[model samples]
Target: MRTTIRLLLKTYRFEFIAITLACLAMAGAELYLTSRLDALALPKECQFDQNISVEQGFATQPEEPVSDPTLVDSCQEKAIAFSDSDQRSAVLMSFGAALPVLAGILIGVAVVGRELETGTASLAWTLSRSRRRWYLTRALLVGAILGGVLLLPSFTANILEHARQPLIDPGSSFNDGGIRGPVLVMLGLLTYSIGVVTGAVVGRQLPAVIITLALALLAILAFENGVSRWESTLAEWQPAASSSYSIDIVLEQDYRDRASGLIVDQGSVFNAAPQVDGGPDGAWIDAHYDSVALVVPGSRYGDVVAVETGAIGAALLVLLGLGLFVVIHRRPD
Candidate 1:
């Protein structure tokens, strides 16, 4: 067992080291960027209590000027809803996570691929190693070594928003807790798994790499056309009105269930005053609040996010599983 482990580890040592170094370096860069951002002061609206006038003669005041630091600390953009840094981080991490897929595909093809193309795979299995052990060990080696290297960057990225994110009011994403880190790690492993599984099936390094790349293209198209098109959840918190149609939450499941011609206008929600204070009712909206509050009839925020989230993981699982199964069942001949 020790010999087999050592042999495999030796085979992948360099690749493992490279991945680890890359993860560490990238994570370090992210941390440094985060620190730099923290140092930069941003424009924040100070909501002082307007009630108590401070007389120059008296120190006693009716109300204290309270500062909600969270407001000041958050990153602001034009879009109020999705202006949080976490959402941007999640999107960036999603693309960043895909980077490992390319790396994994190349490495996966290299591990057993070069051996088979060079006629070393058959000889080694026939002379020294059990075929089943070889396949299983290689899979675990690719999975573990690569998975660990990929996991490190994401784990480190979370340190940025360590205690700032509260469940009661999920703050702008500064950490990896929500979707950024996990998505990156997941995409990396899935892509690498595809490459390894591809190699196992093709039994050649370079060809398997090519095949994996081709398959990745198909996955990309399907991911975009099918999963991402649903409900525009990608930019939900981004405060950007990228969607073609306005969203309405009705108790009914489909749009057909709502009143035929009755359009729900959410122009008010966006136009409404952002400040939370003891101002006159609807002071933000500027009038008799004729606009209705956008309601999600039966669904909730969790449901929307979950649907999009599931699409990402589910697509990865489908591709990785099918690729591995085919490779495992193929005959040695």
Candidate 2:
């Protein structure tokens, strides 16, 4: 193991250094952004106005009209400052999230693909008695390093996420899924697995990196959209509120029959309602149906994260197995 580690460091010193520096920069930026966001105090009016209820959703309204012009001006200034800081933090957070993924791809492909491309794999295979052991030791070592380096940035991203939304629970909110928490580390591992498989198959660094990136993007899109649809299937109906939190993921909106407790088609309700002063009778519709929304609440965030993590873990295992198979069978030419 120590020999393998030394060999890996000697072979990919530049990449290791670059990735480490990038991760450190991401962590620093995230911390800086979080401090900036935290320093900007929320105005009393803004802070007090923001309220959230599971049944009623967010209820944000000023308790009383501002009579003092100076106080009103101060509140507006603070609000604007907070908004600007929040936007900056969000932008940096996104960039920090992508750093680990890119690092994983680079490390994974370069580890084996470069060796194969440069005709060094033949020499390495000649030195090692067992190809399986050789590949596993080097790959696992690199993966562990990548995962360890990624933790710093991932932790900072979590802090920034919470700083940006101090009122909401980051754990329960799915607003930024892969950008923070354990999901980021899992995503990094998944991408590394993708790179290793692609590199093993392609036998070239640059092409493997390209293919790995494309595959990773497609996987991410599929996960995001497909999981959203799946979450909709698991969605439950809740009372539709006039206002909603930015963190909430509402899947569908419709009305429920008050008497039958069944969802009423919105178009059908509008069409069946009697024409009143200008359009459908608002009074009649209100009396017959109550507004409802199909929502995947924050409470289910753990379940959603678990499902996504499991899927990614499964993909990683498959990719790693395939890469190992290729390494064992393929000739180092």
Candidate 3:
């Protein structure tokens, strides 16, 4: 096993080093950016209070200053600065998130596609008695390495997310679903598996990378859509609290009739409002309707992650199986 690992490392030393360095850099950058964001403390008035009750929606909050009026300018300036820093962090984090996918594609295609493309696979196959064993050894080793390397960036991403929303629990929130935590590792592994299968079938690195990228994108889109639909199914009406500190995934936001417990359409309510003097008046709407939101709460984050990871794992198994079958039967040249 050590010999095989050494050989794999030696053969792809450049790619291995590049991916390792990139991951490390991403981790460092995330930490630095998170710290910068954290340094900007929000004033108590600017900070969201999540203790609001369902009956008194954010819209119904008393129109009185909670903090000294003098602090308003300072709060605005800090808020603006924080917002800018947060945007930068988001952009950097996006790149960091994509690093694993890029690494997986490069590593996976190089592992098998390059060998077959350059006709070295023929020699490797001749030396190995069993093609299945040969393929598994390389695939598993590379996959493990990729997963290990991805952890740093994933961990940093979690930290960054926590910094971004200090009030909300990162584990419970789905704010950056695919980019943080174990899900990122799972996504990396899934992409690697995809590249492996594509490489095995295409037998060419460039084309395999392209196809793998397309497949990965499609998989991501499908997975996100599927998860959203699943979440919608699990969604329940919750009091529409201000989302500044909330971790719920709101699907729909509308007013619910407090008395009848029925959803009221905003447009219809506005249209039906009696006009006083020369303008339509909505003064009575607030008394009859309560703002409610259909949402998947943060508590479901674990369940969603589990289901997503399991699906990806199953797909990885199937891809590995298909790749193995191809490698076992295909002519190395």
Candidate 4:
């Protein structure tokens, strides 16, 4: 196994180098953009009540009075700054999402598919190693190389998410949760597995690559949909003070059936204010007018990660089993 891996590495050393360099470039860009945004101080509206003062003179005061005309002009550009940062984040997130597909196609076609097409895989099976061991070693070597290559992008994604902490919806792609870090590497592994299996089964590079990509896409959609359902839960109510919540908080403002927990209707519940305090009338208004926000709090992020990791891991295991089955049953030709 070690000899096989070393020979494979010796042959593909340049290709691995190229992949590493590409990932580094991607990580560098992600870090640079996210770090710049992180360095920017939060605008006044976003920083509300971050540091409140109880003293008579300091209460409700802005963090600092802007006296310079230039500084005042810059202050007015907060919206622009936020927009730019959001755009950068969106770009990075899109790349992160597309990575598995790319991996599936590239690795599936280039590594196993191409070898099978040229009969090199058959030749390898004729050597000292058993077919099962040879296939397993190849799979492991490719998986390890791809996983290492993908680490930079994964780390960059995590860094970008943490740098812009609490700046996006909990259910949104921008939130790290399971879409970044080890989860992404696992996703890539799953994709790679699918690709290699497809290639080995088909013994045609282009067709195997295409099939691998399609399978990877379907798997990703299924995984994402499942994770979404797992991550969100019903909340009976939320506080009226929006300032108390971060942007990562996801709230569903739908009218639900009290008995069935089904959302029967949708509209704003907090439409009016109470006229007075401490009465049946005031209590009615408080109960009715105070909207019930079905919130998914940031505290549940860990749960999201755990559920997604389990789902992805299960998928990887299933793919591995299928791949092994194909290799084990095949006759040497």
Candidate 5:
């Protein structure tokens, strides 16, 4: 076992180091971005300080509101215009947040697919180690490495997710769906497992990498949209507030006439159709919302994470079963 592991390490040392550095760099960049966002949301209250430049008269003075002038455009504007850099940060964050999924694909290809492609896997099986032990050791080592890579970024994302500026859209929350720390880790595992299974079935590195990545993307989309579709069946419907409530995981908010109880419009806080003839009027929608359905409450964010992780885990098990069949039936060569 030690020899196999050491051989694996010797074989993939460069790849492992590169991946570790990339993960650390990505985590650092994310933390830096989170700090920038935190700075923007800093309160505008005055502070006394010796470092203040009395002549410049700026340091001791309170910081100006980071929100743009257009915030007066409407209620929605207030929510949307918190910072000019917010939307940009959000876009960058989205890309940075996908690092784990990307990491999983690369690791899968390098660890399993490439080995099988180069006949190294067959060579390993011929050694003192049994084929089963060889495969399992490789898989477990890769899993442990990926899991360790996840720790810092996951913690950073979770911390910043909760401390996000109030004006940022709830849907954009870092804690949502696959974006959550634990969920991302599960997704990584699922993607890695898919890669291993695909490599075994295809017996080629390039094809396995392509198929595994494609399937990983499909799985992510499925989780993001597919699982949420069940909200209507599972959510608790309550009377919509005339005023905006704390925006959490609201599944549906329906606008209805108070007197006739006729449904006027319905959607999320950001995209709800207005009762009026025109597009959504932020003020009007706020006043007219008569009911809402809560899918997953803010307090139960952990529950949603568990459910999503379980769903991913279930899919992983299915892939594992298929892979087991392939490996058991086929020769390593």
Candidate 6:
């Protein structure tokens, strides 16, 4: 056990240094942003929550009382107008965020690939360390390093966004932008893990690196595009029709103002359609949205970024299982 520990510590020294620097870099940016947020006196309400950001809020007044902008030009204008300042930080962070994934490539080359390519492992195994202990140590170090590879950019991005600006309820983009962080981290981890597995399988340095990077990119794109299709086709379950209150939103005083606080209209929001009746067994899919309400006095609804934490976790587990199978099957047989 002690030998195993010493081997991992020595073998993973570079990985440890990389994760430390990345974390510090992220933490430094985050702390800077924390001070900035204080300086700006950002309100707690404006801070985004993952759950609340995914939903729509009561409309804020349009610069002009434009009817469903999405109606006129497909609301391409709304999406376009904000493109410049909208996600600049998030976009920039993504590129910077992908750097740590390179750690995987380096470690991949160093760990199993180097040993196997040089035929050094056979001699090393003749020593105190068994082949199993050696492989397990390598995998453990690579896994820990890969996990950190996934976190740095996101932590920095979060800090940058909060510190740079007080996330001032940037309309629909808030939730959309918030979702990007987690998705990007997943991208990084997926890429890193691919490198680790490929390195373990292929003993050559350059070939292993190339294969891992290519497969990682493909995996990221495939998953992203697939999930997007799923979101678009989601058939929102509706509720049964009933007599209930609804609000009449209007443009007033240069704001998309709520005419009244959930004004009691005779029509039931429940029966908005055949599916959602605004009540249980209804089509109002957003009922669990008790977290926040439509545009209230101080708060706004973020795009409901309903990420299934469990699902992402499950995907990681599945990939890990496959990796383990591959590793075990390939052992010196």
Top TM-score model = 2
Total backbone collisions for each predicted model: 10, 0, 0, 0, 2, 30
Top lDDT model: 3
Q: What is candidate 6's lDDT per residue for 49-76, written digit by digit as tens?
A: 2122212233322223435444445334
Give candidate 5 regions above 4 Å deviation.
Answer: 1-5, 44-82, 166-177, 242-247, 255-289, 293-295
lDDT of each: 0.50, 0.80, 0.81, 0.63, 0.61, 0.48
Error of 3 at 321 (Å): 1.2
* Better-scoring candidate (lDDT), 2 or 6: 2
Question: lDDT by residue for model 1 over 9-94, one digit each (tens)?
Answer: 78777777777777777677556545543444333232121111212112222134325656534533312322344455455455
Ranking by lDDT: 3, 2, 4, 5, 1, 6
Using TM-score, rank the candidates from best to worst.
2, 3, 4, 5, 1, 6
**Which of 2 and 3 is ahead in lDDT?**
3
Model 4 residue 272 lDDT score: 35
Pairs that clash in candidate 1:
82-237, 82-238, 82-239, 86-173, 113-205, 249-296, 249-297, 250-297, 251-297, 273-284
The TM-score, computed over Cα atoms with residue i paired to residue i, of candidate 5 is: 0.72
Whole-structure CA lDDT of model 4: 0.63
After the best TM-score superposition of candidate 5, give how far the Cα of residue 1 lies from its true spot, in angstroms. Answer: 5.2
Two-way lDDT contest, 5 vs 6, winner: 5
- Give the Cα-based TM-score of candidate 1 against the true structure: 0.57
Q: Runs in model 2 with CA error above 4 Å? A: 48-71, 242-245
Model 5 worst lDDT window (10 residues): 46-55
What's the lDDT for candidate 5? 0.61
Model 5 clash number: 2
RMSD of 4: 6.9
Q: If both were scored by TM-score, which would come out higher, candidate 2 or candidate 4?
A: 2
